[model samples]
Structure formats: structure tokens, C-alpha cells
Target chain A: MTPKMNSVGVIGLGSMGYGVATSCIAAGLETYGSDIRPEVCARLIAEGAADASTSPAAFAGRLDAVILLVVSAAQCEEALFGEDGLAPKLRPGVPVVISATIAPADSRRLGARLAGMGLPMLDAPVSGGSIKAGKGQLTVMAAGAPETFDAVAPLLDAMAEKVYRTGTQIGDGAMVKTVHQLLAGVHIAVAAEAMALAARAGIPLELMYDVVTHSAGNSWMFADRMQHVLDGDYTPRSAVDIFVKDLGLVNATGDSLSFPLPLARKAYELFAKASEQGFGKLDDSAVIMNYVGSELPGTRDN
Target chain B: MTPKMNSVGVIGLGSMGYGVATSCIAAGLETYGSDIRPEVCARLIAEGAADASTSPAAFAGRLDAVILLVVSAAQCEEALFGEDGLAPKLRPGVPVVISATIAPADSRRLGARLAGMGLPMLDAPVSGGSIKAGKGQLTVMAAGAPETFDAVAPLLDAMAEKVYRTGTQIGDGAMVKTVHQLLAGVHIAVAAEAMALAARAGIPLELMYDVVTHSAGNSWMFADRMQHVLDGDYTPRSAVDIFVKDLGLVNATGDSLSFPLPLARKAYELFAKASEQGFGKLDDSAVIMNYVGSELPGTRDN
Candidate 1:
């Protein structure tokens, strides 16, 4: 069935955004794809995006929803309010679905700013990475007014397998997503530590993988990311830098509450170290290399 | 079919050992149980144990396999070699199935000591708690000679749902179990940390549990243990001291290899801190109190 939304623009056509735009097109929405790189726009258009442009003027008020699949809250603000942004051009009351993993406070602030401009906002942060995004199976932790949610239902349905209505409060979506990142980042870091312990203990990495995946020690992250470790492929399915940013947000949120997040802090430090050591751009499983001698293929030296 | 073994003894009839002994009885093996606590032995005898005695002499040579289900390698050694220990009384060629979580080196030493007495050894370390032990559904990570495995197959089947033949090499079972403990311990620590972050972030504790258990952040431990957190129950299904001990073994094993297990070390420290603060005997989820204000029901302050 055709999505009810007439047009939805996807900004930031990077790995995750690209899949989201493609999924929108697959669902028969009038999907407009934009990216900083003209080649990325051209690539999305070639793969069935209705149109590709850097300028928002072509769609303007015709766009029913804009999915801001950018990197952070700052990027979301710049995309919406910058000189060439869509804020002035988009029709009043059009919902902006913010899918970036930003701090909860920033989400609320951004939502309020958009609402001030007579635009409703859906504070929606996504999980399940790029592959899931391509399959239209990403999970959206969403919070906004019922009307805002209703307006974006078509777009969300096209891009997500599950859309959790966290609350009506603008930042609630970000709050849940932030909590998720805390666990995700921590699990990955600990997974790396567990693997490192296994490696250093002389346990066969394959056997370690098998046993852990089947045993109580298993986590979704450990089973998924450790495969990247086993393959020695550090290609960035999810980059280490993402955790560096996400866990930073986790710690900051905890700090605001005077909450002691000892484990999150340690995980953040590991990700920060990985980024500093130049493995930031690699798959996050490359954190395993920090513990084991750099046996992985994507080490900076290699 | 009746188990090939005539009589089997379970030493250290604590919560876990009592279950093992009962399961053996359920499987129609003649089971003897021993415990330091007379009441525990009395309880086991009431359940189904053929005999309950503090002395190993009650079934020593007659026990075709003795499942050592104590706390540590030291306890395993003491049970076997201490004055009135089973070592001197066990029949030659009877296999002593060592099911305690211990250092791989210690397992090897135990195996060697048993072999010196013409007794075979199965370095089998079990997972799944007392509940599973009672149902004959524990997972046994086992290593020993083929003959030893063949001879103990019926008993293994009787007591375990899955018995992984990790290797024939002595201590391989302990090696795998040690690695399992590394992940299990870290996952629990990080889970507590994540729950604390959520609790302090003003996300409702139940919501945090629901979202996390559904998200990629979920681990087997988190799903199982976070319920205790949600109920504010500190009843010890597994006490905090267990991780203190297990993670200690993990760190020690890593230390022996000069392997840097940074995450495991941090988790070990957290468990150690919880122990130091006198929550050692509380449920392991009490580690959450270390992060949040001590509002949980079983906090030591209360």
C-alpha cells in the first residue's frame, strides 16, 4: 500500500539514512533523498529515490514529513535552521522526525524550537543499525503529540519494524534511546573485554564464540559484534566513534543527575581510547584489538 | 535404562549440590549426599537421597562417580584430600567429576592428583543454577579421557541437559568455564550499571527493564537478574560474592597469562566493592545499590 504521506525527505544519506530513504521508496512514498555528497544523492536516486537534491526548494511545502537522520542534535539543528535549511520552506505543521541519537535535553529543546515555528516534532531515535534500516526493520523509540505521531505514521511504518511510543513528552524517546545506548555501549565494551580474556587465556576464538553465544554470557551485541572480530573484518557496520559519542551522552546525562555510572564511564573510556588510537573509524569490535595484540586485519598499522 | 553407575555421591550439599544429588536420585542412581550442615543433609535425605552423611566413608569406594559441587578449587581439594577426605577411600578407576568453578591450572593439578591414585578425573564445570540442577537440565562443560567420558555418559545424561565435551585435555572444561565466568560477571556488573543509570535518569525502573530486555543491550543475565531489581528483591538466587569469587578467578587466569582484561578487572572491582560494603551475601543485583541510593529492599543499611 502507498504510504499516506505525500512526500518525505531524508537528510543525511549516510549508511543508516541511505537505507531509511530506500525503505521509504520501497514502501511507495514520494521519497526525496539529500546528502552533502552529490554522489550519494545520485546513488539513492539511481536506487529508486523519487528525486535527489541538496536544495529543499523542489519539494518545499509539498513535503509532509522530513526525517532528520543526521549524526547529532547540532547536525539536526543545522539541517533544519541553517541558511539552506528546510525550516522556512516546509509547510506549517509538518512533522519533523528527529532520528538522531541525541541527549534527551537536546531533543526536548529541539522539539520546542520546532514547535515554536508551528511545526510539530517527533523525537524519534532509531536502533538496529543500517542493515535493519535497509530491510525497513529499524526500531524507532518515538515520543511526541498524538497528532504529530499520527502525521508521521506512514513514514515511520515504512522505515521501522517497531515504533515505540515512549511518551508524549518530546525528550522521552531520546531518554529511552539514551538508556539503550548505555547498555549497548557497555555490552560491546564488555564483549571485547571477554573476548580479550579468552584470547589471552589461549582459548580458541572460534570456540569462545560458540560457547559464549550458547551460554549465559551471551548478549545480542556480543553475538553480533564478535562475528566481526572472528572475521577480522573491522569494516564499520557500526563505528567505534558512535559509542564514543553515545556513551559520552550517557555519562553526561548521569552526571546531570549526580548518578554514578561507573561501568558506562569505563566503557566510554575504552571507546575514547579506541578513537584516540585511531580505531574510531573501524568497526566497534576493533575494541577487542585493544586487549589482544592487533591481530585484526583493519588495524591502522596494517 | 538404569544409570551404569551403582552409587554416586555429591559432596558439599549446599543449594546446588543438593539439587544435583536429588536429580541423581530422580534418575534412579543410588545417590549419597554430604554436607557440613546436618540439617541440609537431613533435608536432602528427606527429598530422595539414599543416604546423608558428613563423612565420605558412607559411599566413597562405592560411588562410581563423585560429583564435587563445592565453592572453590581449595574446597574441591579439601573434599578430596583433607583428613577423612574421599581420595583415600575412593576405589581405583572411579572417576571424580569435578564440577566446581576453578582455575584451569588447579583443575589440571586435581586431575593429576586423581590420576596418581589410579582414579580418573572429569574436569566438568556446570552452569545453570539450582533450579536447572534440580530438573536435570544443567549444562556441563566437560573434559577428560574418552574412556572416562564413556563410563560417565549415563550419569552425565542423568544430571545434565547438555554436556559439552570441551576437550580431552585436563582443565579444558575449567578453561571454558573460566571464560564463561568472565562474560557472566562483566555482563552482571554492566547490567547493574545500566539499571542504575536508568534509575537515576528518571526512567522508571520497570520501563528500563522492559526496554533493555527487548533491545540489543539485553543479555541472558540482564533479563534474568533485572527482574530481581524490578521486584526490589535481594534474595540471593546467586549472591554478589559469587561474582567476587568468579571474577577473581577470571582476573587471576588472565594475570597468569599476562593478558590485559581491563573490563573483567573493572567488573571484579565492582563485585569486590559490593562485597566490601557487606552486600556480599545479598543477591548479585544488589550491585545496583552501589550505583543508586540504597533504596532497594535488601540494602545492608536496612
Candidate 2:
């Protein structure tokens, strides 16, 4: 008989992880949340998540599944294998659902390491922003052995609207997710580039956004990100640094395969430039600032 | 009093022009069609356009409006002022609607030249594609004097679903259209780049298409064009050379403004390369072949 995923431990209560934890709690799971920030932990508990201890090991063998939603693969590695990490405390064969966007090679290596220690690793990297995570509508591009998926099926159902079982190989989910980021990163870069050109060319930025969202040039990222640019609101829902890291992973993968990815590489450089200009912590759409710095285009009004 | 657009001449019956001509006829206007190609002219007549002579002078004085849907600014100028052109034959204040994608500077120059001939030039470049043109649902980014727009109102209504009267400046329509092309060209190029990356990364091409169309990575061009790439069909709905010219116009405008558009320029180079590889006449999505030419990425599949 398949085991039920009745209790869950969510690590890294950042924007995305907090939503995941809340959704799990809303679904009646005994959800626990932990972050390096104590306030974040307090906030999640206020939102109905079970109380979490400062040390990740507190939930150890109690978790039926662990959702790792940290910033990067390095953070994910530290959470699982670093001092006071959950690896030594969890029961053997409990599945770890990895949700960060990381390089496929790193995911494979981590999967191997975890498997060697009798843990089943589910390579699941999610798409959709935090908003979707809150609504339990995020798309999870996931892969692992059929039995491991069976073990965490209840948790997957609670957190995702569309779960693409990409392949059985633990690395395949990360592979597809990386490819998805290549497009997402490029779309945001092109959105900034195209919108700045329009603004400089004497079209109102708002008009450009309205026309484009209705035209063939429209993209999900363009529609979503450019709205933030149009609103002049750079409150970081997804920061520029996120693309910095994601596109960096893209470039590294292309390099490993000897593939030439000029556009994605160009997008990466733009995000890096924006990050350097001190817009790293702002919304990802603030990459537009790299093009229209210190003033909105087409006018000296600023 | 606003005069009805009783008779109109549509020059250059290409994919887009043919649609514009048929749509004009469908709107009950006496539409005359002309093309360098005899067969295209014949087809338009069969589609209910009025008969045409080899010379554009056939309906010159009879036309209340002339829709110039030719290839470029040069073609637009030639159709109006070239040998046996319609310039000398047109009466003063007859509005000529220019619907080709060209630089704003060129539009101003043409507007000035036509104004010298007593014609009220309406700088109108349309969006949506051939299908929308045929359905009379194109979006026209237009600019001219209010009186000229009033004079050409009937014709504009016949040809477009959305008519954005940008301003009274003759160059304004072309400016907005140029900006629109910047997005459209970059979107197509990036769509090819992203889809090709996914194809090479071991994701089945069709599955990648499905996941992306439903994901945040989706773009109108990606959803529309990648279908051609996936079907292995290169039947040109829109050719690569089209982007070559459009992006060249984008490059020229950016240069004139001293603005940096590295990504648009990069996309232009890829389309140019694809054209050089004998895919110029193929569909624009053939740009994907540039990446996956020698092999698909992971397995020795394709």
C-alpha cells in the first residue's frame, strides 16, 4: 500500500517557499516551516503553519516529505548536508522533493548522494511565480522513480496544478526546468529591451505595454514583468539576481554541451549589469533600468 | 461632410496586400488591385477586387484613398512617384495610406514629397498578419492631421480592427510601428533560440512545446511559429528575410537616436545567418535549425 504524505517539512520560507508552506497547511497537512530568519518563521506560524524549530533537524523523522525551496543549489546542498542539516535526522528512504532551479548535473549528483544514504530524491523544479504557489497552481516539472513518486503523490497533488512527469531519471526534471529558465530569462530581457526602445522612440510606456500584450510579440513574462515596469514599481517579487543566477546556470550548461546560446548569454549579461547598478534586489523588470537609467525615455521631464 | 470611401486603389498584391485588397472589396468599396505579378492581380479580381491596368494611373483620380501595402519605403515611394506613378494623377487632399513597415525618417520624407503633390499622406503601418488583413482586423498605428484622418475615416474603418491615432505628426505612425517590429522581431528570434535550446536539451520537441505554451515561457510567436518547427514544415507564412529588413530598420532607428539595442541586433544577426544558409524563403521558425542543425542535444536522436 502507498503511504500517505500526511506531514511535511518545508525549508527556506522565501517568497515561493512561504506560499508552498501555506498551501500545504491549507490542505490540512501537518506543515512545518523553517527559515534562517526567525520573523519569517513567526509569520508562517501566524498563517497557520505548525511551529518550526530554529534547527532544521527538529522536524527530522517526522516529515513524510521535505520540500527544498532555497535560493540555489548551494543553499539546497547546505540545507541537506551542512552542519545541522536535515540529512542525518530524517528516516531512511523518506523522499526529498527538491524545488529550486539548479543545474541538472548538480541535481543528479545530489540525487546520487542522497540515494547512497537511503533517501529517495525527487528532482522537481517548479515554474509559475509565488502567486501561483499561493494558489496551489504552480507547474512542477518533475522526475524520479515511479515508487518514489508514489511515496510523495499526495504532497505533489497539494502543491501543483500541473505536474509534468518528465522522465524517470532524477536529473531530467532539472534539465527541463533549466531549459524553461533559458526562455524565461530571455523573455524578460527582450521585454526590457523592446519596451525601452519604444519608450525612447516617443511612444508612451503604458501604450506600449497595452499594445504589446495584445499583439504577436506578447509573452507571459512580457505581460507579467512589463506591468511592473509600467507601474514604476520595483518591489522585488522576483529580483534581477534570480535571473543572474538562472541564466548563469544556463550559460554553464550550454558551455558544458559546447552549445552556442548567444541570446541567453546576452540576457545574462544585461541582468548582471542591472544587478551591478544596484537593481539586483528590485523586481526583475527593473532590468529595464539598465536601458533607461536615471530617467524615463523620450522625455527630459525626469 | 465626410465623404464615403467609394473607390480605392491597393498597390502591390503580395500576401498582405492581397488580403487588404480583398478586405476592401468585402467592405463594398470599389477596390482596384495592381501588382507587378499578373497572376496576383487576377486572383484579387477573382476575390472581388475591381479590374486593374498595368499602370497605377488606372484609378488615380477616381480614388478617394490609396492603400500602399508594398514591400518597403522605396517601393512605397516608387508606387507614388516612380515612372507612370499615381502622384501627378491624384487630386489635392486625396489621402494616401502608407501601410508598409519603414523607418520614421523615411515616412516623414515620403509624407513631405506626397504633400508637395497635393496629397494628404496618412502614415499608417498595420499590425496583425495576412490573415487579420484579410479579415479586416489589422491594427493600424496611424498619424496625420485630424482633417486628413477625418477624410480617410471610412477607409481606415474598412481596413482595421484597431486604429490608434498616434498624433498629427506624419512620422509618428512609423515610429510606433518601428517600435512594434522591434518587439516582434526579437520575440521571433528569441522564440527560436529558446525552443531550439529545449529541443537540444533532450526534451521531446512536442512536449517542450506543450509545456512552454502552458507555462510562463509562452509567447505569441513561440506558440504560433514553433508549431511549424515541430511539424518539420518550412512553408513560409512569414519568411526570414522579412525580419532581416525589419531588424535593419530597428538598427537604423536605434543608431539615429544613439540608443543601444544589442539584443535586437543580435537577433538580427541570427535571422541573417539563417537566410544565408538557404532558409531565407523558409518560415521564420527555421532559425531553430541554426542551433539543432548538426544534432539534437542529448541523445544521438535526430
Residues A1-302, candidate 2: write the lDDT tens digits.
54777899999988889889988988899999889999889888888877775677766878888989998999988999998889878987789999999998899999998998999999999998899899888999998999988998877887899999888998889888888898899889888888888777777777777777877878899999888777777888889999999999999988877888999999999999999988798889888877887763333442
Clashes of 2: 0
* Chain A TM-score (model 2): 0.96
* Whole-model lDDT values for every prediction: 0.85, 0.85
- Residue pairs in collision within model 2: none
Best candidate per TM-score, number? 2
Model 1, span B16-124: residue lDDT tens: 7888888889988888988888998898889878888888786786787888999999999889998888988987788899999999989999999999998899999
CAPRI-style quality class for the chain A–B interface of candidate 1: medium
lDDT of 1 at B185: 88
Q: What is the TM-score of chain A alone in each candidate?
A: 0.95, 0.96
Candidate 2 ranges with C-alpha deviation above 4 Å: A296-302, B294-302
DockQ of each: 0.68, 0.73
The weakest ten consecutive residues by lDDT in model 2 chain B span: B293-302
Q: Summarize candidate 2's per-residue lDDT along B212-289 as a digit string, tens digits.
A: 899998889889988877777778999999998999999999999999998889988999998898878878877776
